[model samples]
Target: MSEHKPVPGHRADYRHFHAIQTRWMDNDVYGHVNNVVYYSWFDTAVNHYLVASGVLDIERSPVIGLVIETRCNYFASVAFPDQVDVGVRVAHVGRSSVRYEIGIFKEGEDSAAAQGHFVHVYVDRESRRPVDIPEAMRMALAAIAVG
Candidate 1:
C-alpha cells in the first residue's frame, strides 16, 4: 500500500482565517521565518478563533484545551515584514479532543506556504483530566469542521 503524502491546502479548504503580522525577530539567520515560529502561529490562530467566538475564557474557563500533538509541512518560505493569514478547520471533534488543521498563507496568496495540524485534548482545568467538550465550544468548532 502506498502512503498518502500531505500537500499544501488552499484558502477554500478552511472555514476560518486569522491574520498575523510577522515580527522581525521571527526571521532566523537564514532570513526566513523560522520553522518554530510557524507552530506559534498555529497556536495563536486557533486560540484567537476560540476567544473571538466567545467560547473560551482563558482566565476563567473551567475546561482548557491542551495540545497533545502537533506537526507541520512547509512548501515555501516566508519572512518578516509580511502579513500572513492562517486558515483553520476541524478535521475531527471527539468527546474530549479535537484535531485542528491549519494553513499559513502569505498575504493575498491563494495557496498555503505551510500546512500543519495539532490535536487539543479538552481537560478539566483543576483536575487535569479529560472532559467532554462544552456545548458552546462544540458549536464554535462545528462552524469550522470539515470532512
Candidate 2:
C-alpha cells in the first residue's frame, strides 16, 4: 500500500472561507461528526462562494456545476455545537472542470480539523453535457486559484 501524504490544513493556504454551524444530528453513533458531513461542508463552502461571487444562479443559470469526484481526510474530531470555518481554494481549472480544495477549521482556529477536495464539471443545465466554464465564472474562480 502507498503511504498517504497529509494534506495541508493551514488557514493561510486558502483564499476564501465560509462558516457552518454544526447541527446536533450531524453526529453519528461514534460521537463525533459523521464522515459524510464533511463532504456537505465542502460543497456548501465552494458553492456559496460561487453564488456570492455572482457566477452561479441555482434556479436560472444556463450552466451548473456537477460534482464528479470528492475526497476528505480528517485530522481531528468535531462534535455538536461547534462552528466550522471552511477555507476554500481552487487548485486547478480545466476547460469544463474545476478542482476545489477545502479545509475545515474550528472557529477561530488556524489549523484545520479536516481537509478535502472535489472536482466539478461544469455542464449545460438542460442537456447535462459538459460546457466550457463561463467567462464570468472563470474570472470569479481565478480570484481564489492557487498553483
Candidate 3:
C-alpha cells in the first residue's frame, strides 16, 4: 500500500523515459515487489537522465548531487519479468537543488504502477558544500521540467 498522493497529469509531464525490468529478487512473500524497490526505480530513472545528459560526472566532477528528500506512492503491484516504464520530469529546479518527479508505469499501461519524487542538492565535490547549479546542468534539467 502506497502512502503518498498521486499528482494528476503528472504522467504527461514526463519528457524522459527509462525502462526497468522487475527482477525475481524484488518480490516479497506476498508475491509483489517490495516497497523499497520503488525508491531504487526513482534513483534509476533520475540518474539515467543525468548520465545521458553528460552534465554529471560521477567519477570526478567538480560538483556532486546529494539526495536530500524522497517519497513514493504505489497504486498497483509489479511482478518479476514485468517491464516498467519510468517517466521522469523536473518538478522544480533551484540554484542548488532539483526536484525530479517520477512515475513508474507498467509497460504499455496508461497509468503508473508507482509515483514519487527524489530531490538532489548540488554541492562542491571537495568541500561537499552546497553550490549554485551550473548553467549547463540547469539547462539539462529544464529540458524535462514540468511547470
lDDT measured at residue 75 in model 2 versus the true structure, 0 to 100: 89
Candidate 3: segments with Cα more than 4 A from true spot: 1-10
RMSD of each: 1.0, 1.0, 2.9
Residue pairs in clash, model 2: none
Give me the overall lDDT of model 2. 0.95
Whole-model Cα lDDT per candidate?
0.97, 0.95, 0.87
Model 2: per-residue lDDT, tens digit, 22-130?
Answer: 9999999999999999999999999999999999999999999999999898988999989999999999999999999999999988889999899999999999999
List ranges where model 1 is wrong by over 4 Å. Answer: none
Ranking by lDDT: 1, 2, 3
**For candidate 1, lDDT tens digit of each residue in 64-108?**
999999999999899999999999999999999999999999999
Query: What ordering of candidates by TM-score runs from best to worst?
Result: 1, 2, 3
TM-score: model 2 vs. ground truth: 0.96
Give the better candidate number (2 or 3) by TM-score: 2
- What C-alpha lDDT does candidate 3 achieve relative to the native structure? 0.87
lDDT per residue for candidate 3 within 25-47, as digits (tens), equals 99999999899999988888888
